[model samples]
Target: MKIQSASALFRVAGMAALLGLTVGCAPQTQLLSSSSVDRPITLGLSAADFEQAAAAATQSMLESGAVERNDGKKHIMVVSSVLNDTMQRIDTDQLVKKIRVELLRSGKVMVTTAIGLNGAEDQMNTAFSELSQSRKVDRSTLVKQKLAAPNMSLSGKILQRNNRVDGNKELVEYYFQMTLSDLQNGLAVWEGEEQISKLGSAKGTSW
Candidate 1:
C-alpha cells in the first residue's frame, strides 16, 4: 500500500471534519442574561447590548417627562431611520423594537404601524382599508376609521471605534445614540447615548 502525501492527508481530514459538521456536533443554543453585567463578552454587537441600551434609554426618556401631555392621551410615535456605522452587519431594529415595546407598555407613547419613514410598517393596514372601499364588501360591516398621524419621530445611530490597548490586547467601543423629536415643532424632545467597551486579544476581529 502507498502512503498518502501530506496535502492529501490534510484534505481527507478537512473533508471528514466537514462531513461531521453536516451530520452532528452542532452547537446548542444557550439562553443569555439580558442584563448588562455578568454576561459573556463577544467581538461583535450582541443582543445583550441592544436590550440593555433599550431598557435604559426608554427609562430615561420616561423620566424626562417628554412624552407627558395635559390631555392624558398617549403620544403617537413613528420610528425613523436607525443608521448602523459599525464594521459588522447588524439589524438596528433589535434596539428599536425593544424601545418601542417598552414605550408602549409604559402607556406614555403609542407606536404607529400605519406610518413610517418609508411607508406603512404593516401592509395589512393598507390592504384592509382598500377592502373596506370595495363594493364587494358590505358597507355596514366596515366601519369608517381615520388613521392617526404620528406626533413624534424616533431616530438613532450605532457607532463603533477600535483601538489597541497594548501589544497583546485591543479595545472596542460602541456608542448608541438616539433622539426623539416633535413633529409639529421639529425640535428634539429627548436624546440619549449609551456606550459599551470591551478589551480583547489583538488578533480578534470585530466584524
Candidate 2:
C-alpha cells in the first residue's frame, strides 16, 4: 500500500510539471505604451492616431487668437455634442478626453464637469445639489450652491472615407474636426481639423 501511494504521488508531481512546461511554451502577452507605437497595424484608428489628432487640434486652438483674454481669467468651457459620423463604433471620448486634458494643461480654458449637452458630466454635482432635500442629512453642512455657466461650448465631428487604392490595398482617410463657440455671441471662435490617412490591406473594418 505504501509503494502504491508513493507511485501515485510521483505521477501527480510529474503531471504538474508537464502542465507547467506546456504553459511556459505558450506565447507571451504584455502591455505596450501607446506613445511608443508609431506604426499602425491596420487601417483602423489607434491610440497613436487619437494622440496625434488631439495634439494637432489643441495646438491650433491655442495658437488661434480666440482663447486669448485680456481680463486674465480662464474661460469656463462645457463640452457639447461631439458626433461620431464614422463607420466604426467609437466613443467620442477617445478623441475628446485627450483634447480636454491638453486644454486644461494649457490653463487658458477650464472645463466644467457639472454641465454637458446630455446632462451633468459628473453626476455627483447633481447629487450634491439635491443634498438639501434629504431629510436625514444635516442642514448645517449644506453650503449654498451656485453653478457657473460655460463661457464657451465645444463641439466636433469625426468623419471617415475609404477608397480602393489597388486590388489589395485601400486608402482610408479620417478627419478629426472641432469647433469652439463663444456662448455669449453664439459664434465659432476657433475651428480646427486634423486629417490622418493610411494605406493598408482592405481586410476588416477599423477596430
Candidate 3:
C-alpha cells in the first residue's frame, strides 16, 4: 500500500512538471502603448491651405478633360524616377502614389509595374535566368495573359526652402510637383504643384 501511494505521487509530480515545462516553452505575446504631448506648434501655412492646393490641382486636371479612355481601354501609366531637392528627407514616392491612387479611382489611368528603369519591368524573369539552373516554367500553357504596355508615365520631385528670422521661429517651405507624360510622345500632358509650409521654434535650443 505504501509503495503504491509513493508511485502515484511520483507519477502526478512528473505529469505536473511536464505540463509546467510545456507552458514555460510556449510563445508569449507582449502589448505596447504610445502617448503624445501637446506643445507649441505653428505652421507657416495652414493645413486648410495645403488641402485646398491639392484639391485645386486635382480639380484643374479633371476639369480640363484632357485625359480620356484609350478607345474603351484603361489608360496605362508607369512610374519614373523622381528627384528630391529638399532639406528634409522625404519619400517622393508617397506623394506620387497618392496621385496615382486618385487617378485610378477616377477610372482614367492604370499603372504598369512590368516596365522599369532598365527597360523590362519583370524582375522575376531576370532573377530566374541568372540562377545556376533554369527554373523557367512553360508560360504557353498558362491561361492568364500579360497586360498591355502603359500609355503614360508618372514622375515628380520635391523642393524645399528654409528661412530663419531673428526670433525663435523658422519657416520651412516645400513644393511637391508631378508630371504625367504621354508614353508615345514623351511629352508631359499634365503637371501640378502643391506647396506646404511650417513655422516653429527650434527644439532643445535657443534661436
Each candidate structure's TM-score, on Cα atoms with residue i matched to residue i, is 0.83, 0.91, 0.61
In order, the Cα lDDT scores of the candidates are 0.90, 0.89, 0.66
Q: Which ten residues in a row have the lowest lDDT in candidate 2?
A: 31-40
Model 3 per-residue lDDT at 157: 75
C-alpha positional error of residue 128 in candidate 2 after TM-score superposition, expressed in Å: 0.4
Model 1 TM-score, 2 decimals: 0.83
The CA lDDT at 154 in model 3 is 72
Which segments of model 2 are wrong by more than 4 Å?
38-40
Best by lDDT: 1
In candidate 3, stretches whose alpha carbon ends up further than 4 angstroms from where it belongs are 1-59, 118-141, 144-147, 202-207
> Model 1, range 88-110, lDDT digits (tens) per residue?
89999999999999998998899
Worst lDDT run of 10 residues, candidate 1, spans: 1-10
* Native-structure RMSD, model 1: 6.8
Candidate 3 lDDT, 1-207, residue by residue in tens: 999999999999999999999999999965533221222234433334434445655566667675786588778888888787865455555555556667778887777766767665566644544453434656554444454787787777767787786666677777767777888998889888877767666442211
* Native-to-model Cα distance after best TM-score fit, residue 71 in candidate 2, in Å: 1.1
How many steric overlaps are in each model, in order? 0, 0, 1
After superposition on all CA atoms, how large is the RMSD of candidate 3? 9.2
Q: Per-residue CA lDDT of candidate 2, range 79-130, in tens?
A: 9999988888888898999999998999888999999877898999999988
